[model samples]
Target: MKAMTFKAFAVVNEIDLNKIAIHCGIPKKFTWEEPLILKGAILESILGREINAGQMVLIFSFGSVVFINQTEPSETTILLKFIQRFEPDVEINNADRYTDDYKLHIHENESLELADEYVMVPEFEEFYPELISTVLAKSVALEKTEEQLGKIHDRLETMIDRLEKGKLRIGNKELARTTAKILRHEYNTLAYIMILDKPEITWSSSTASEFYDKMMEFFELSDRYKILKSKTEILYNIMDGFSTISHSIRGLFVEWVIVLLILFEIVLTLLQIAGLLP
Candidate 1:
């Protein structure tokens, strides 16, 4: 009998769950006797267990239900070609985005994809070589954009600093940061998973809503700060210009006084020469 197996993983780096299963990574050598493959979340919840790092879970079944399907007609065919372009550490092993019901097995190898680092795009006009400073702000809306990213940076720094340094673990799907960070690239919007020290892998979509909501509020506050700062800068620039103009005018008046004094002395000398006035 040909049985298909699906492999997946999650991290309990900081989850506050009771470890239902002990250090045994995989339950069985193969799970084919029951012929029923249960969902990972359900299995996890039912068992009241937390999956740790470097753990493997194997789910076996007769056929397979796969997610992460290729959108294009030839996506499957070209998958290999595309995969070759990226490093194994950067590869994503999935048939689709998400699945609740499926037959699957999971191995907790240090897959390059799980612990991969994502890059942050900075929003600065000076950084853009093609655009001048004056036009860059208008084109990129830099103040608005920077405020958004600035809030993210600030929030992350604050969370990391305020919270005890540890891994984030989860028992419920409701606190998943799956949508905000993984799919959406909104890293600062991850929900509160119990924090513990461990190699963390957060792939749950459970915290997306909460994360997004928090981030939206953060963005609004940042926008307001940016507006206030812009106005302050403008006011300061105007004051500086006024001071410079005042100094220049003062110097011009002094020069005019000196010229008039020279003219007056010349007139006195001419009057003395003509003997018409004292």
Candidate 2:
């Protein structure tokens, strides 16, 4: 028997899910309310040809459109090519699995474990799409954070150079302001990924929830999530340090100005008392 291959693709940054539902001719019975999950029928081409080797499930969410194919590698390529024709604007990222080498034992809860590399499920739901989208979103967010961090590092270096030259500069305040803006942007990005992009699965089905939790472990989604969270915290700490340094410098400059003004006043009074001026 040929092994089953599972392939998932994140086809877009955001999709008008209503448009997808109408385009796919989704049935009322197959739609979910909370997170707006829709499942389409087995997709066929214009010539009435099946899109993939076995079956294709079309899933749509707010920021992601996923096509799960149960097929071989060659057929998978054909399926992706067909999708790209209609979705020219999407940015695609994929996760793949091949289940040939392992002994498969079908469980009652619609999930089958094939060794350590692959897991098979009878149906695709909100969990699968959410998992795939979270992975892609985290990757994109991580890249953005790294890029911002590089800019922050460069600015810190420039500030250190000016200080070494004994120049009391206010540019650090501007740098702090810019860093605050970047920090807000990064915070929003991470928040959207963590909170808004969550999967809203109904808890009415214990089996479904169990399967999802198990699959999450199998995919190591928690590990990736933790890593991203840690990086965001580090970025926050650096920005906080910059803010502290900026305030400290500003305070010292103000104190020096006050001292210089007092000294000037004392000198003027001494000069007048000594009759050195008219």
Candidate 3:
């Protein structure tokens, strides 16, 4: 009847793992396969709390943190502050967040199964925490990206409404800003977060792979990512259409000015020949 609470936050765009490792005096090479684990004395010191038993903090390079068994809000807040030293841009009060409670029953006569946020296992495994934390961190990161795309979608919708009213009032500066925002979002999702990629451990351990797959499906990560991509393409097309229309309008205005200038020149020549103007 042992249980733990996992709270994950997507706080920043990216974390400089190398800098944090060096400052923390960690010698081992930090990689995407694993997160920086903090527990025991280090965790207590960072938290400034005496009772941090069974509590663990997992910091991923992709700007998410999973606090295992650290259910207290104050504890979570304090640890985030500590992380801010390494990642100054980390957003502490992010809107996209995740929390789940899991019950682990070990040494039981039941089969190993994870269902409805409960785990029944014959024996406790060491990699359980890592596996769980990885999924939680990734899920939270996707949640943050989803929120960003949602905002972009709303902005596009507003533009569409204006277009419906025959109001294409976007200037060059506004167009450039919108294009840059969309491209930056795509790049961040692909480069820093790499949300579509699975954890490296999954390639080696079949059990880990299966668990990761199930968790990903539960979170609808793949489907949501595809939707985001589709929305991005639609945005691109809309911008292209806007640019084309603007160019056409400018060209038509130039043609009309050229015609008017020619007509004025002909009228002046007629007046001069008839001795009506110099």
Among these predictions, the greatest lDDT belongs to 3
- What is the Cα-based TM-score of model 2? 0.56
Which regions of candidate 3 deviate over 4 angstroms? 28-34, 50-54, 94-107, 268-277
TM-score of each: 0.23, 0.56, 0.85
State each candidate's clash count.
21, 0, 0
How do these models rank on lDDT, best leading? 3, 2, 1
**Candidate 1 vs 2: which has more lDDT:** 2
lDDT of 1 at 154: 54
Best by TM-score: 3
In candidate 1, what are the lDDT values of residues 1-278, reduced to their tens digit?
11122222121111111121222233534322211222345434433454332222222121111212112323322322222232232123432221222121223442211111111122212111111111211212223233444554454454445334542222123123321322222211111210111111112333333332333243343454355446444434533443454466667879999999999999999999999887
Residue range with the least summed lDDT across 10 consecutive positions in model 1:
193-202
Clashing pairs in 2: none
lDDT of 1 at 228: 44
